[model samples]
Target: MQELPGVGLVERARAVAPLIAREADEIERSRRLTPSVVAVLIENGLYRALLPQSLGGAEAPIETFMQMLEEIAKADASTAWCLGQCSVCAMIAAWLDPDTAQEIFNVAPGILAWGAIAHEARSVEGGYRVTARWDFASGSRQASWLGAHVRIVEADGTPRKNADGSPEVRTILFPVASATLHDVWQAIGLAGTGTDSYEVADLFIPERFTAFRDVPAALREPGPLYRIGTGATFSLGFAAVSLGVARATLDAAIALARAKHPSLAGTAMRDNQAVQGLIGRTEGDLRAAGAYLYATAHTMWRDLCATGEFSAAHRSAVRLAATWTIHQSAKVVDAAYHMAGATAVFRSQPFERRFRDMHAIAQQIQARDTHYEDVGKAILAGG
Candidate 1:
């Protein structure tokens, strides 16, 4: 791993987020960033940290990615959501062969924004023509590229067959100019994420630009970094998002609690034993969540960098740990909301914003019922 400079990208990201925090409510209502706010994040290089140095990027560690995302999310979930997705897009740029990597990244390093996961892709004479309606393309509104998972289909546009008549899935990359974005991210919470839909009709992607989702641990044709799994990156990065939102929630609750008193009226809210206990509990949960999350994510990534031998089981463990941290964050934020009482409910209160954001975090599939079940099943089967 390259040694980063003092204060680090994570700390710098936090420093830049305070202003955005002030506008989180507006962001939730507006469903997109104001132009000025968007510029602040872009100048800060938040989107390119996951990109490789060859492309004039930070190439920061997974832990740094999380810390940065958490800070961005703390300010505005939608901005962070979109920005985080863009950062992940840079991940694809870092994994391809150098020649292909240069074509997408060298000309405009840290500029590509992508969406989608490997659902399927297949071979063709010139390249790969892909089809899929990738949902949750969080950065589609400001992206220059679109990506999705697609399987090979016949010349007639039907799914192709394998020798055994089975199936295979692959990642497909397409320039944003060739795709269409569907503005359908209308929800009651985190509306600012602008996670609209994108579709590509017979978009042909050059073979050199595509990276298989399941390359071996850190083994790219030209760079070992290409071997890492996309899931690993998402697990670590999303966990940081959870942490950031939780931290913001706590900060807001503390500020509100200090200014107000408990309705039961024995003391100021901050001075109340129950409130203190909840705060104390929330702090504990946040601490454990962060500690476990960073420890597990860093361990796996470090092991991969050191020996290039991290197993699928190890990766699964990181996924479980990251998801669990998010779950813990939700629990703590819920307690913060309860402790803040009525103040937490008002739109003027940051708690109201954080409350919604935290709920959204817990509700995301990665942090919710499905991930929990995956972890549970894995543990039961000794995964």
Candidate 2:
């Protein structure tokens, strides 16, 4: 292990604890991170942790990213969601040309926001004319730019052929100035994430600023961080969201339960067997989910750094593991709400908000159906 320098990540998060918690409700109400909260994140330099050191970032170990994610999520899941996407994208920036990366990190290390995950882009003159509507662009309300996806298209609209005569697909980074951020994220939970959609009409993107290739995790790029797997980024980021929500829900429930008494009897809430059972089960579930996620994340990172790549089978396994971890975390959070009785359901308490947010997170593509199918196929082929 390399010796890290300067203040620790844990310390950085501690410095912002009051800030993230202070505006969490406002974030939930407005469906976006508050300016104060963003400032705290920037000042702490959390986003800089993922970018390569050469680009004026810490390029900290992947383990640090995973653990820090859990801590941030615990404070505010929506803010963490916005934080997750930005920081995870920083890893991609680390892999980019130093010049192109400077255009992003040099201005402000942890303040850039992006949404170019899915391969929805194509090539054009000088660069690529991207034409696709990216969905669930988390934190879009405050985004300065977007890393969107595009598929190659002929001027007549038919898909174009690549060098091998196959359909060409690429991720075109469309600046926020050229795209429209649609406020479609209204929901019962995770409203603060500002997970809106964006549309681009004949947006021209230059090639120098884009990364058009297979998934980063699938790439054999000489850099160790780039070879983990194409989809692990989604898994890690979403799993961190789950851990955060579960932690928040559990904390809320405990606080309320400790203060209240069981309604039908003279017993205190904490003294009731039923309440104890709920707490026990919820805590166990949360611990298991956190443990599994951290373990798998560390393994993936270590393997990548040492081997420069991991097998496709191992990568798929990690994704499956991470997805299941999210599901488990949700179950634990729901149980926490049950332990808190009707009090947890009231809008006044954080429990209801966290519950809604967690359920919403579970429905994300990273946490839902598609991955189940992917894992099933990988299993049948022999894991």
- Put down candidate 2 lDDT per residue, 1-383, tens digits, no spaces: 75372237767875686689889889988889998887778777776666666666666665676667778888888887887777666666644566776776676433445554454344456876665676777766655667665566765667877678877665555457788778898787888988888888767777776664345532323555546533576577678778877888888888877888766778888777888788887888888888887888787777777776666765776788788988998898888887777787687777888888889888877887788898899789876
| lDDT by residue (tens digit), candidate 1, 1-383 | 85562126777677778878776667777787666667777777777777777666777767677778887887877778777777777677655777766666555323555555544454677777666677877766666666776676655667766567866455666667788888898865668777888877666778766665555532343333444556667767777888888888887888877889656698877778877787887898899889999888778777877876667677677778878888888887788787777777888777776677777767776775676677778889977
Query: What lDDT would each prediction earn against the true structure?
Result: 0.71, 0.72
Candidate 2 residues lying further than 4 Å off, grouped into runs, are 1-7, 109-122, 155-158, 161-166, 213-222
Model 2 clashing-pair count: 8
Candidate 1 lDDT trough over 10 residues, lowest sum: 217-226
Worst 10 residues of 2 by lDDT: 212-221
Model 2 global lDDT (CA atoms, 0 to 1):
0.72
